[model samples]
Target: MTGRLWGLGVGPGDPELVTLKAYRILRDADVVAWFAATGRESNARRAVAVHLRPGQEELPLIYPVTTETLPAEVSYEGLLAKFYDEAAASIGALLDDGRDVAVLCEGDPLFYGSYMYLHNRLAAYYDHEVVPGVPSMLAGAAVLGTPLVSLNEMLTVLSGVLPADELYRRLVSADAVVIMKLGRNLAKVRDCVERAGLLARAWYVERATMEAQRVLPLADADAARAPYFSLVVIPSATAPGR
Candidate 1:
């Protein structure tokens, strides 16, 4: 019989946050795969490293480029497309050989996880399962001790890379919001939040649940120090049970 493909979410930073199901599948898989930057260690692998037993083959899918900034001749989308295609092929080869392959994702596998690209490329031809894990946005709220959404409130999730005017418009209309992907875009995102009059209500969280975790008011955050894992969260104005 052909081997099954597993997309396992290792949760946000903390190893304790990994779901029992994900751990079990990860431990039993014949091969473990994870995406990482060219030289950096894989956060997803770190989350479940202890659980991996002897004899499991490890597959490291190194990214060709880690940042959006690239040479004029290179296309980010095209490069990534080719990369994922090659990665899918590698995993497919293992499956064809009856080796169950589990792909480790940092957060929920389907929520902006690299595993989604692999799933899209190979799920049609293979038996697979996706195990959801704790997403970073929720982890951010937990660290901030803030309620994310209240009754009848809508929570909007936005990418920090959006244009200034677009970010402002969305922030203005949002009841509760989480803006992710804040690295070099921190200044722009903060500016948009301030323009939308949500800066006072917004909280900035970095590396939530990790040893380097930090939480502060968005208005007071230093844009120059923001990392890719940082995010801005605006909790609901209405308190729960009020």
Candidate 2:
């Protein structure tokens, strides 16, 4: 009697940024799921709080990104694999009872979202839907007043953890670059942009629409110290020869 599960993108940090369609989906969903690592706050769930009514069930999936401290026995990926399997089993339990679940996603569901993991696990046995929301890169671009791309300009979105060689090559070829998860990788990323002669055009923004947002020209920020939510954008060079 229940309908399919929906993975809804709640947009960036600001609750106001949530899309109307995503809202309609969450407003009616019987169960809502979100992810949060140990000792951290659940911003994704907070982004959709207004839509949830009293007594509605909310589930939190504890997903911790493995760092080197973890032993090789269970391995980081192995542990995560277990978590995903368990999460799928739990969701499936609810689905078996005909309860439609809506999982909350920050930014777009497919763009570096955790919802994909849940979707992939349950898609085979359950009906599903994904509602796209505004991406942080686009929101960061707007906050900084930078045009993301124009005619014939390539746009590359890089995570903070990409290998140095791959990051350098892409920086050189792309007309515009938006590097997400700038956090601890800011120094390395900034250095690459500088070496590639794109430093003058680099800009960074953190938390996009949230009150604590930070926006800086790469030249002004002490790249080595930017926050985790920050990202950098490199616009096309104006002088072809310079």
Estimated TM-score per prediction? Answer: 0.96, 0.92
Clashes of each: 0, 0
Per-residue CA lDDT of candidate 2, range 80-127, in tens? 888999998888888888988888888999998988988899887788
Best by lDDT: 1
Off by over 4 Å in 2: 64-68, 223-225, 238-242
TM-score of 1: 0.96
Local accuracy by lDDT, each model: 0.90, 0.81
Error of 1 at 218 (Å): 1.0
List clashing residue pairs in candidate 2.
Answer: none
Give me the overall lDDT of model 2: 0.81
Candidate 1 lDDT tens digits, 119-226: 999999999999999999999988888688988999999999899889998889999999989988898998899998878788999999988898888889965758
